[model samples]
Target chain A: MSARDRILGAIRESLGSTPRDTAAIAAEAAALLADPDAIRPELAGPSLTESFAAKAWGLGTTLDTVADMAEVPAAVSRYLAQYGLGPGLAMQQAPELTGLDWSALAPHDTVAPDEPVALGLARHGIAESGSLVIHSAPDNPILLGFLPLHHILVLERRRMLPHLEDYAALLGREDGIPRNAILITGPSGTTDIEGSYVRGAHGPGFLHVILVGDEE
Target chain B: MSAPAPQAGFKARAAAAIADPTLKIAIDRTTGTAERKRAAAVAAFSEFEAARARGKAIKDHVIAHLDHYLETFERNATAAGAKVHWAASDAEACAIVVRICREADAKLVTRSKSMLGEEIGLPHALADAGIERAETDLAEHIIQLAGERPSHIVWPAMHRTREQVAELFAEGHHPPPTAFDPATMVQSARHELRTKFLSADVGISGANFLVADTGATCTVTNEGNAELTTTPPRVHIVTAGIEKLVPSTAHAFALLRLLVRSATGGELTQYTTFHCGPKRPGDADGPEEMHIVLVDNGRSRMLKDEFREMLRCIRCGACMNHCVVYRQIGGHAYGGVYPGPMGAVLTPVLAGLERSRDLPSACTMNGRCAEVCPVQIPLPTLLRAWRGRSWRERLEPSGLRYGIGLWAAVARRPRLYRFASGAGVRLLRRLGKGGWISRLPLAGGWTGSRDFPKPAGRTFMELYRAEQSGKGGPS
Candidate 1:
């Protein structure tokens, strides 16, 4: 009779025996279709919220390349200064994050690992899905991805791959990042709770991005 | 040492697979999302075409010289204190793995996503051996929990919804309903598998690529499960096809760069760990021993066959993702662990066509699969080749054979064939509605979902003949 009725009829016909359980499944489907945030929240069960990828872009920032590394510490400093992550917060190293002056922001007393990163910045990024590709290597600390509540990433413009097929050109791609190159698109997110998404569940709560242009 | 065959057929299973509303929702949304992301991912590459060609060329080169690379890989892996085992068939592979599991007294095994394992039905063997093998990959674990094979390669449990997953988790072990939070699921899984990982006597992983130069193996995963799955275990084993090996790290990198973007629309996964050997000297947190089981398993046979180009496949599944047939029918319809365009060719070759005949004929030869294949495996051509094999093997249906034979007899003489076609068209047109053959004997399949454009009153040759001879006295 109606779209709902048709769907219900379809479900009834499909389920044969498992009618009620199928009803619950149908309702969940309707709810998921009805609103995504509801699903996101249910995914988190309204208990634990995880970060969305967009938030990760917001918390920490990015620059186009390592040449623009000079501007990154200042950007990271300003972002971190507001939050006071400077004096005591720990900094994890990424291979791409190497050559950046960490001392400028915080002189000493930094923790190495966090249950969730406060600030996580990726060393390499592929522009295709706005994915951040991180390889676990010595300089590129694996802790940066998992630890900290806030995360900031410095992505080189040159490193951004347009397609998944473009990685054939990377040096030592076979070896991969010696440590861990975490290709992160967004902040840590979880839709696992009840179907609703919660950001910053296990990883960074915030993701700030700084897209470094060629001239900038 | 095998589980009974899954009773349901492809269409039945696929229909059942999409029955879960949440799962359907999840599949539609996730696949839709992946498609969009893939579009964006491809858009960034100005040289996508060139990359495809180059990657295919590299893979082709490797497959061509596979024997050389395999030998190199063996020597290097042996040099690195890794023992290499070769299995000529799925049974042999399983036998080798079970023997290793037995020898090591490995009561428990944690495995990362190994489709090859699914192909060989490894879990049943492990079950028969009474060795617990836990699927470590989150998606694989979900399928493992369901006691079902993976429907999609890249996202193995691509068809499951959180609620369905919750229900699965609710089964057997219930602390509460399954959490939908991807993170919680991760944690729940981590919580559940934490003990498994810690206590696992052995770890088994499938390599994304095997580096011959360094005797290294790589497994890529989004979660850190792969790392824990291998490092914490006492004995770590890697299983893969011989073609998985490349000459050097450079070649492996070449494959890796394309793997994530092509499969997951990411530049790379979070964890792409390389398991070289057991805890080497000072390596505190790693496996005590490492062994690589190189499974030939019908591959070398294919190497000398016409379908040898299929060996270059890196299992990236772009062809699967892009195939319209696959998108409509879904993966399970291929009736194998491997599905889509690649599966159509591979299923028959690897498993024998008598059991896998439906695969080759299942396709419409749309050519989209070949367009998307990273290694440029001419999937349709390979499907045709398989069709030929089936024909030669007398697997073709009698009706189809008779019809084709009749058509061929008529086609031998162009005049009779044209007359027959033209006369048939005219007769059909006479009975047709509004110039289109909306229905016909055995032709309803063509008109079921789409319209068949009306043929002209006369054939092109007839028109040409009249025009050339001026028989109609046209101005």
Candidate 2:
């Protein structure tokens, strides 16, 4: 017998069942897919944006609040200046960030192999863990998030969810999950050497989130 | 295949670990920080208990109906252009991975940390097939350079000091530095592994959770090496145990809630990427082909046994961090890929009781492992179960058996027990010097470590009888 057949057979014999009802299995799986039960953690702040920023800051992610999308370049420039970095930034060709006035920041269309900064747009933000949800597509490439010294994520405050469960609910509404939907909490780090945490292990050393269009 | 015979038994290994002051200090510092951080992380979640309950329930439900979920995962994964392979044993799994790499004409392979990969000896298998593999995770890289197996599940190089790591880097890489700064060492490894990541033909990683609903494989990592290992190569291979299957993304998140907090005391890992499948037709980055190798090894048998709860482990490493015995001896003393409280119970199940019979006895039965276990695995109960099995099979030494038998016989009769205890105490008092017994026959094991306290002048029964008779008041 094939490995699959033998393995499944062993599992069946152990479970003491043979060929469960397909319809029943499908119904169970579908029901779970539709509305999965989860325990959502309550946040400290009154609004999702504040809660997200507070939690994100705790995780070592720098945060900047912008009143509108047009101010993103200025925010990015200010952040770059604060870090004593020059004005060259790599970014994806997403519609949300395409027409911005990035002249001040000298935004590049393609991310360099050793790009010091990269900007990307977040599809959603999770409040409980302060994670940015980025969906991989042609417009928003996945590498923009990982292959830079600094990662600047532009997110709309309205897209922030209360917890991971709410993000799952949002995915349920979509036709199909994307090829890659990453939930990144902070910059890369490791405690491998004698349990000392050092940031920027094969990913961005710093994470900066730009929250735009707040509730007020 | 059975695990290779340990270089030495648990007693000898643990003795050496205890003697090594450096190992003790490293283990103390690392596990101490891990425990403190885990406490704070769990406390941050007001619903930690509820989340743990739901996580356990989800895992139990999935394990009960695993066949259905695996089938669903295979179907959905295939639909998303990922090839799924099943392996009933370690050899088959390694062979499948080798075949895939060979077909892809892979020369340099980059790998993220995978305990299952270690269990199957994937690196050895690939080496036999003439493929060079680079371990990208910093801890794994250190161990690989040092030519060692992982001591701890989460912290593979917990046994190594920063000085040792600096030495290994100097020996293994070019332009070695003189200082032993962790930050500099990490930056050096990042630069070295970055070349491998860009040039590798295939990337291999392990999945923390496999979502059946979307055919996505999720990996949680603080270092983000798994992301690099998965994205840069033309082909990405995920070697996961069959038990890693969860019903939905929501269930995955529920378990993730406990996994990160319990493992490293982080709210979430730096990166929790869910790779649905291979890159879509216009995707700018991602592997063109993806493969999920579901390894059974000995898990299927475990699923049917009384020790099935062992399968619910999320590899959090909390049990070891809080375990008294594990805290003293470290992971190398266990003489297995996995160590600590979880290893004590699991190594026996996977490797068989005859070879690893001493593991279950290594625990102090403090029950701390169960308390901190995110999935609520009754670890002490499982350890005791193993001991019972070993006793029934007479796996213990005949000397021990006869000794216990004698004790049981004497304890069944109160008068004989009282007489024996009284006589033994009096004799010990004679032999003991300055209120401490420096040595004793048949107890050299206990006395070898420290001096044994002398027994009181009288047995409890003697004092009790005197008090009852209203004789000179008992002290």
Q: Please, what are the lDDT tens digits per residue for candidate 2 over residues B1-475?
A: 1122377788888887787888888888789999999999888787888778777777787888888999999999999999999999989999999999999999999999999999888999999999999999999999888878888899989878888889899988766754569988998888888889889999999999999988999998998899889998999999999999998888888888899899999878999989988999888889999999999988888888878888899999999999999988888889877899899988886688998999999888889999999999999999999999999999999998999999999999999999999999999898799979989987887787668999999999998988878965545
lDDT of 1 at B383: 93
TM-scores of the models, in the given order? 0.71, 0.95
Once model 1 is optimally superposed onto the true structure by TM-score, how far is the C-alpha of residue B108 displaced, in angstroms?
3.3
Q: What is the alpha-carbon RMSD of candidate 1 to the true structure?
A: 15.3
List, residue by residue over A157-205, the lDDT tens digit for candidate 2: 8888887878987884774688888899988999998899999988999
**CA lDDT for candidate 2:** 0.88
Worst lDDT 10-window in candidate 1 chain B: B1-10
The models' CA-based lDDT, in order, is 0.63, 0.88
Q: Give the winner by TM-score.
A: 2
**Chain B alone, TM-score of each model?**
0.88, 0.95
| DockQ scores of the candidates | 0.04, 0.67
lDDT of 1 by residue, B195-235 (tens): 67668999888888887766778787665566667766778
TM-score, chain B, model 2, is: 0.95
lDDT of 2 at B39: 98
